[model samples]
Structures are given as structure tokens and as C-alpha cells.
Target: MSRADAYHKMLMSVSHFQHNIALILEAKALEASRSSQWLCHHLSAAQFGQNHGEQVKRSVEIHDHVLDVIDGLTKMEQALAKNMQALLGEPEAPDSGSLGDMLPLGGN
Candidate 1:
């Protein structure tokens, strides 16, 4: 495959990885919110029987880890884009409010 084709494929793979991580983060946040609500309800009703706090804590940890992964991935993607541009001898293009600008990490 040509260098440009290979770069495009790699970019797509990274974009997919980011998308999946975002999905996981969304799910974890939802779980944490529900757990918190459940814990609050139990506490208000004076029925603190189950350990919902642990579940909430775990969910929060997962959410945080996902966020960290996203941050690192973003940095790596930016670096990769820069390196690829240098390798391809391409000049930086103006934004022009393209679709990529609307998507996260300049996804197409």
C-alpha cells in the first residue's frame, strides 16, 4: 500500500479506538450515576443494607481510567498526525470549519 493509504488506515484505527473508549466511558458514567442515586435513596429511607458505595466507587475509578486513556490517546494521535504530515511533506492546511473540525480528534 502507498504511504498515504497506510497512514489513513492507521488514523482510522486510532479513531475507532477512541470511539470505543468514549462508549465505555459513557457506560461507566451512567453506572456511577445510577449507583449514586440508589445509595442516596437507601440512605434517605434509612435502609442502608446493601453496599452501593463500593459499586459507585468502582464505577468512578473505571470512568477516571477511561478519561486518562482518552487524554493519552489524544496526545499520541496529535503526535502521530504531526509526524505523518512531516513524513508526507505536506503543509498544514487551514481549518475552514471542515467536518473533521466538528468531530473529536479530527475524525473524518
Candidate 2:
């Protein structure tokens, strides 16, 4: 294949990669929000007590774990973007507010 054709294919692949990443991020955010809402509703239904406190603690731990998984996904996305940039002989784009920045957990 010609260089131009190869370059075009690479760009197409990168575009698809970006689109898929966006979808994954959106799905994860929705799941996290649903989980948080469900936890809040249940917690409110139950009367406050030692058991409630323990439940809240466990809920927080689970949320933290989910956030960590999200962070890992974000990192993988960034790495893929950088790899695509390199493959296309393009410079890294300057820092901008990414989807990760919009996360309530601050993408940490």
C-alpha cells in the first residue's frame, strides 16, 4: 500500500479508538452514578446505627475501588492516544480538559 493509504488507515483506526474510549468512559460514569444513587437510597431507607455506619464504610471502599479502575482505564486511553500520535508522526497535543477531568472523583 502507498504511504498515504497507510497513513489514512492509521488515522481511521485512531478515530475508532477514540470513539470507543469515549463510549467506555460514558458507560463507566453512568454505572458509577447509578451505584452511588442506589447506595444513597438504601442507606436512607435504613435507620442510622452501627450497622449503617459499617455499610457506609463498605460502600465507600467499593466506590474507591471503582474510581481506581476508572483511573486505570483513563491511563490506558491516554497511552493509546500517545501511541497513535507517535505512529502518525505527530506531536503530542497540549494538555486540555479531558473526560477524566469531568469525573467527580477528579480522575484520581
Candidate 3:
């Protein structure tokens, strides 16, 4: 396969991953929100002497994992940008525009 073709395939794969990860992140956020609400309701009802630490810990762990995923995604995007710049033989200016804008028109 040509270099452009390979790059396009990689871009598509990353796009798919980003979409799937977004859905997963949304679900996780909802789960954490529900857990928080449940804990709040129970606490307000004067329920005491129960260990709520586990739920709080789980929420924190989820948040930390989400942050890690975000960091990885950011790095992936940066690497893709560098690869694109190299493939195009032009250094892309920061904040110039989307990668689509840099791609050649009419299948050059």
C-alpha cells in the first residue's frame, strides 16, 4: 500500500477508537454520577455506620483511569500530527487547522 493509503487507514482506526472511547467515557461518567447520587440520598436519610469508602474509592479510580485514557489519546493525536507533517513534507503550524485541511485535494 502507498504511504498516503497507510496514513489514511491509521487515521480511520484512530477515529474509530476515539468514538468508541467517547461512548465508554460517557457511560463511566454516568455510572459515577449515579453512584454519587445514591450515596448522597442514603447519607441524607440518616444512614450511618455503613462503609461508603468503597464507592468513593471506585469513583476516584474511575476518574483517574479516565484521565489516563485522555492523556494517552492526546499523545496519540500528537504523534499522528507529527506523522502527517512528515508525510506531507511540511511542518504544520500550531493551531493552523484540522488535518483534513492539510490533506491534498483531488487525490494528489
The candidate that wins on TM-score is: 2
lDDT digits (tens) for residues 14-93 of candidate 1 = 67876886787798679879977986677542343367786677668867976897798678767766766676677565
| lDDT of every model, 2 decimals | 0.69, 0.75, 0.71
Model 2 over residues 15-80: C-alpha lDDT tens digits?
A: 888899889889988987997798677755355454767767877888799889878986887798
Off by more than 4 A, model 2: 45-56, 91-108
User: Candidate 1 lDDT (Cα, whole model)?
Assistant: 0.69
Candidate 2: residue pairs that collide: none
Per-residue CA lDDT of model 3 for 1-108, tens digit only, reads 998798889778767877887787798779879988987777542343356776577668868987997798778767766776676578755555454455544332
Candidate 3 worst ten-residue window by lDDT: 99-108
Model 1, residue 52: displacement in angstroms? 17
Give the clashing pairs for model 3: none
TM-scores of all candidate predictions against the true structure: 0.45, 0.65, 0.46
